[model samples]
Structure formats: C-alpha cells, structure tokens
Target: MAGIYLHIPFCKKACHYCDFHFSTSLKNKEPLLKALAQEIILRADEFKDKIVETIYFGGGTPSILAVDEIKNIIKMLRENYEVIQVPEITLEANPDDLTDDKIKELAQTEINRLSIGVQSFGEKELQMMNRAHNAQEVKQCLQTATQYFDNITIDLMYGIPGLSNQEWKQNIQQALDFGISHISSYALTVEEGTALADFIKKGKYPAVDESLAAQHFDILVELLTQSGFDHYEISNFGKPNAYSKHNTSYWLGKSYLGFGPSAHSFNGDIRSWNVANNTKYIKSLSENQLPSTQEILTIKDRYNEYIMTGLRTIWGVSLNKISKDFGLETSAFLEKQVEPFLANGTLVLKQNQLKTTQKGKFLADGIASELFWV
Candidate 1:
C-alpha cells in the first residue's frame, strides 16, 4: 500500500521555533493550489498500480485554507489516483482554525482523521511560541472536534524553557481528559535560523535544558503508557489499533508520493523533494514540470535508514530481515556494534528483534547513529 502527502505551505504567522517551509503571505495561495492539483495529476502514473491507503495534508498550516480549497484538492487526487474506498485522509490543523463550523465542514468531507496542532495549553508557552491560539481555543476545539471525529490526534510539545515537569504532566493530562486517541509529542529543539535560536543568542529566550527535557520525556512516556496509550513510536502515543496509518507506512519503508512545495517522496530506492520556494514550485508546475531533486539510495544508506527508524519504533529491527536484505557481513557488523548496548541493558534481543529497553528509549537516535553502516 502507498500514501500521498500534500504540503500546504502557508501560515498566518511564523512560530518562533518553526523551521518548516511556509509563507506568511497568502498572495500565491490560488496558484499554489492549482500547482498542487497539477502535481497530483502529474505524478499519478507513479502510484497507478498501488492502492493509496492514506492521504495526509501536512504543512506550514493546512487549516489556513478554506474547506472548499481542501475539498478541491482531495477531489483532484481521487480523480487521478487509485485512492482506496475508505482511505485514512488526515488534515493537519491548528486549534484556532478549527472552529465549530469548520470542524463540522471537515466532518462532511472525505477526510477521516484530524491532527490538531495543539503544541501547548499554557498561555505563556503559547505566546513564547507565537502560536495564534490560546488555552481556551485548545479546549474549545477539542470539545468540538471530539464530537465530529473519532480518529483524532493532537501534537503536543514539552521542554519549553520555563515549562516545568509538573506543567508538562498537566499538558498530557489535559489531552487525556479530552479522550484523544493518538498524540504526537515532541521535545522543543531550537533549530538554527529559527527565531527561537536568535532569541537564545541574544538572551531573549532561555536556552533549552537537555536534562529538563529528558525529565519531561520520562513523565510523558510513563503517564501515557499507564493511561493505556502505546508508545508505538518514540514520539507518538496511540490507543490500540489507532496508530497513524500514514506515518506508520513511512516508518515501515513503504512507497509514498508527496506533492506541493517542500514535500518529499520515496519509492523504496530513490527519494526526492520538491523545491522549498513556493513561487518556483508553482512556476515549474505551470510549465508541466516537477521541481524536485532525487537521490538513489546506496545499500549503506538503506541500511542506516532502517536502523534509525527501526530503533525508534515498537516493531524494532529484525535481525533476520537485516541478514537477508543487507547480507551477513553487514548483519554481523550490526550485531557486534549492538553488543555494547545489549550488555548495558539498553537493548534486548527478543524474538530476533533488536528492541530498545525503557532506559534506552530516549537515547534511541544516538544509539542508532553509532550503529550506522559507514
């Protein structure tokens, strides 16, 4: 099965810590949508033979568009691609944009899932992140959203400089209070070139503390797992059978087509990304051209990718699969490299899968990098 990702690269305002491609102005919104539709038709042949199980509307802010605009794009995708009869169509939305009318309108569409961007419910944290919504909006949106959709997920962030562990726990509890089925929580990382980075450089914002973030992460995992949510992926928690089908397909190395500016696509061997500039993306597609760059994955590249994604997931890395796919030499190298982690109780070999222990879950990325095939 395959998936489709459409990037909506327009936002009302820039978040202090955001580094994703997006425009603050809506000047090119019309042209961008047209280009996006054109892109769907342009790339239809690639996935003609594959059944599209998911269509994700990810973004700078997908909710920035009107309901009709989103519907038009979905209609275009259906006309061009062999989308399944009941695909898991998800739209990433901001809390402020999800008003009662908007939520009801979305419920009437083919979109079945809603990934709300409710990073934090704290007022100070909201202002610090330059989010448009306040705490009240979060509660209002979820109250209304839960009424309309069942397969809902909300994005939460921990590790804000002044956000204490207690506050972080409260944030998770607030989400649980709403009966959210899936949650994607992340630690706040200050990316270079973002406003948050500049603020820290000038002492305008406090630096992110690694120890505090780790503490918050521990709290997150313990609370969510106890609340009956599976920590299926390092950054994601889902109730049983409620895992994100689109993102799961991605981690499992399934083929997916991404349309619009700054989106990426993968088809097993080669990975490609569209240009980040909206104008350039639209102009290229106006001429019936795809503005993207691609790379052919080397055996080492594939193996390293498998290691990175595998270690972060509940499924873990399969030793037998690695042996069959990457040969005995690479498999042996991996086994030797992982011995240290296994000996330290950071990883365990269960059912031939190299799974992370609770102690090693937070450090999964670092451990995976050390075991990368050079």
Candidate 2:
C-alpha cells in the first residue's frame, strides 16, 4: 500500500525554531492551491497500480486553509487516485484554527484524524515558541477536538531552556487528561538559520541542553508507558492499535507520493523532493511539469535506511530479513557491529529481532549511525 502527502506551505507566522519551507504571505494562495491539485493529478499515474491507504495533509500549516479548501483538495485526490475504502486521512492543524465550530466542520469531512500542533500547553512555553495558540486555546481546542476525532494526536516538545520537570510532567498530565490517543513528542533542537539559533549565537537565549533533554525523554517514556501508551516509536506514543499508520508505513519502507513545495516522495528505491520555492513549484506545475529532484538509492543506501528506521521502532531490525536481502556478509557485519550495544545491555536480541532496551532508546539515533554501512 502507498500513501499521499500534500504540503500546504503557508503559515500565519513563523515559529522561532521552525525552518520548514513556508510563506507568511497569502498572495499566491489561490495559485498554490490550484498547483497542488494539479500536482496530485499529475502524479496519480505513478500510484495507478498501487492502493492508496493514507492521505496526509502536512504543512507550513494545513489548518491555515478554510474547510472548503481542504475538502476540495481531498475531493481531487479521491477522484484521481485509486484510494482504498475508508482510507486513513489525516490533517495537521494548529490549535488556534480548531475552534469548536471548525472542529465540528472538520468532522463532517473525509478527514478522520487530527494531528494538532499544540507544541506545549504552558503559556510561557507557548510565548517562547511564538506559537499562534496560547495555553487557553490549546485547552479549548483539545476539549473540542476530542469530541469529534477519536484518532487524535498532539505534538509536544521538551527541553525548553526554563521548562522544569514539574512543568513537563504537568504538560504530560494535561494531554492525558484530554484523552488524546497518540502523542508525538520531541526534544527541542536549534536548527541553524532559525531564529532560535540566531538568538543563541547572539547570546540572547540559552543554548539547548542535551543532558536535560535526556532527562525529559526518560520522564516521557516512563509516564506514557505507565499510562498504557505504547512507545512504539522513539518519538511517538500510541494506545493499542492507535499508532499512526502513515508514519509507521514510512518506517517500514513503504512507497508514497509527496506533492507541493518542499515535499518528498519515495518509490521503494528512488527518493525525490520538490523544490522548496513556492513560486517555482507553482510555475513548473503550470507548465504540466514536475519540479523535483530524485536519487536512486544504492543497496547500501537501502540497508542503511532500514537500519536507521528499524532500530528506532519496537519492531526493530530483523536479522533474518537482513541476511536474506543484504547477504550473509552484510548480515554478519551487522551482528558484529551490534555487539557493543548488546553487551552494554542497551540492546537486546529477541526472536531474531534486534531492539533497543530502555537504556538504549534515547541513544538509538547515535547507535544507528555508528552501525551504518559506511
């Protein structure tokens, strides 16, 4: 099965730590929507023989659009693609846009999931992140959203400079209180060229502390797992059978088509990404051409990718699958490489699947990189 990702590259304001491609201006809004629809139709042939299982509306900020605009886009995809019956359609939204009325409107659409961008529930953290929604809006949005969407997930961030563990605990508790089924949490990082990075460079803000982030990660896993949420992926927690099928497909190496500016697509081997420029993306599609670049992933590239993605999930890396696909030598190499982590009790081999132990999870990325087929 395959999935479709449509990027809506417009936002009301830029978050201080965000570097995703987007424009605050709505000047090209009409053209962009047209281009997005056109691109979807243009790429429909690629997935013509593939069953489309998921449709994800990701962004700049997907909620920035009106209900009709979203409906039109979903309608276009359904008309052009061989979408499965009762496909999982998700829309990423900001809390500010999800008023009670808006939430009610969204529930009537084909969209069945809401991935709200409630980065933090604390007023201080909200202001620090330059989020469009305040603590009150966050609460109000969740209260209303839970009424409509059962498959709801909220984004949460940790490791803010002044956010104490007590505050973080409170944040986790608040989400639980709302009965959100999924939680995708991440430790805030400073990306270069973002306002947060500049602030740190100019000594206007404190640099992110990794040690503190580690502490928060521990707290997050402990609390969520105790609450009966599965830490299925390093950055995601979901109740049983409520994991994000779209994202889980990515980790499992499924093919997907990504449309609009700055979106990426994969076809089991080759991976491609569209230009980040909206004007260029629209202009190219106006001429019925794709404005994207692609690369054919080598065997090593594929193996390394599987290793990186597999190690981060509870499914883990399958030794037998590696041996069958990458040959005995490569499999032997992996087994040797994994020894250090296994010996340290950071990794465990269970039923031929190598998975991270609680001690190794926070360091999964680093460990995966070391075992890369360099």
Question: Model 2, which residues run further than 4 Å from truth?
Answer: none
Weakest lDDT window of 10 consecutive positions for candidate 2: 40-49
TM-score of each: 0.99, 0.99
lDDT of 1 by residue, 1-374 (tens): 99999999999989999999999999999999989988988888898799999999999999989999999998898899888899999999999999999999999999899999999989999999999899999999999999999999999998788898889989999999999999999999999999999999999888999999899999999999999999999999999989999999999999999998999999999999999999999999999999999999999999999999999999999999999999999999999999999999989999899999999999999999999998
Q: What TM-score does prediction 1 earn?
A: 0.99
Per-model C-alpha RMSD: 0.6, 0.7
| Residue 357 of model 2, lDDT score | 96
lDDT (C-alpha, whole model) for all candidates: 0.95, 0.94
Instruction: Give per-residue lDDT, candidate 1, residue 229.
Output: 95
Q: State the lDDT of candidate 2 residue by residue for 234-342, as single tens digits.
A: 9999999799999999999999999999999999889999999999999999999999999999999999999999999999999999999999999999999999999
Check candidate 2 and list the clashing pairs. Answer: none
